[model samples]
Target: MTKDRSVYIRHIYDCIGWIKEYVQEGKEAFLQDRKTQDAVIRNLEVIGQAVKDLGTDSLTASHPETPWPQIAATRNFLAHQYLGVDLTLIWNIVEQHLPKIEQQIIAISNDEGIDLNAPNTPELP
Candidate 1:
């Protein structure tokens, strides 16, 4: 059986949202704020874990080119040694990679005929 695509979509949304808030003051602020780094990194971890939990079929059928494994591996790397996490790399991942992920997820949801604006944006745990 396959997991709901919305769950993973929500994860992507969440990660993106957190990054948005973190970067409100711009890249300079994000680079200087330890708290934002912690929050963003954890959300990135969730995005990866959620992607891993998604069914292989859904991913292969729709978002086939996503680097799901690499995303998950990044989560593991962050979790084990967060003290050494790279700000530039995290910024790159959040600013560059996540929007693409979010776009792909939205495309998949639209293809499935799911209403993205439905009143059920689950809060990140």
Candidate 2:
């Protein structure tokens, strides 16, 4: 269970790094490229899965700043709603939102004294 605790944090870091890498071409390029869009969506799904795995109690006790419900819901939206997927909002999430969460993850990892950058299954951001 102790190791499981880090799963969500690592997952968040992984998603942030992956999203950053996927959107290197900027939002305009991201919006135009279907493969990039798919990659981003899949990463979001992984992030949401991590959030869901973290659960409410763990999030509140450890990293309460994360909007766990919204993260999980967004994952559901991306995974389930294909036709209604909004590229613009996703762009906003990646460009405007990811950095903030990335910082938050870094802060929490620092406070916990965990080396998130240490090599793991997906490798940390």
Candidate 3:
């Protein structure tokens, strides 16, 4: 069955949270740990998938500042080019892109009246 838009919104929030949790030890720690790198990469892919699922047209129009297309593209890159993943690019994304995304997702959620912390799906680690 198809999901509600809020479900995808929550997924984006949760994935960002998971990425933040994985990188809590900071940049050097992240760069040194393959498992953390892998976790962040996987969460980014999930964020992309959730963004794609949320449907680009309306969401992009609503929040034009958000880079919906690039986020989805990142997901595609991660899925297809997993073997050649660039740690620097991923690190930059975590350090930079995600906060903006997290903010925009919050904006989208508030504007759309979706409670991210609501009891819908189980939270992922």
Q: Which has the greatest lDDT?
A: 3
Task: Give the range of the ten consecutive residues with the poorest summed lDDT in model 2.
Answer: 1-10
Candidate 3 local lDDT, 15-111, one digit each (tens): 8999999999999999999999999999999999888888887778999998798898889999998788989999999999999999999999999
Off by over 4 Å in 2: 1-3, 122-125
Candidate 2 clash figure, as a count: 0
- Model 1: runs farther than 4 Å from truth? 1-3, 119-125
What's the alpha carbon RMSD for model 3? 2.9
lDDT of 3: 0.91
Model 3 per-residue lDDT at 43: 96
- Estimate, for each residue in 19-96, the C-alpha lDDT of model 2 and write its tens digit: 899999898899899999999989988887777776756665777776767877888889888887889988998878
Ranking by TM-score: 3, 2, 1
The best-first sequence of candidates by lDDT reads: 3, 2, 1
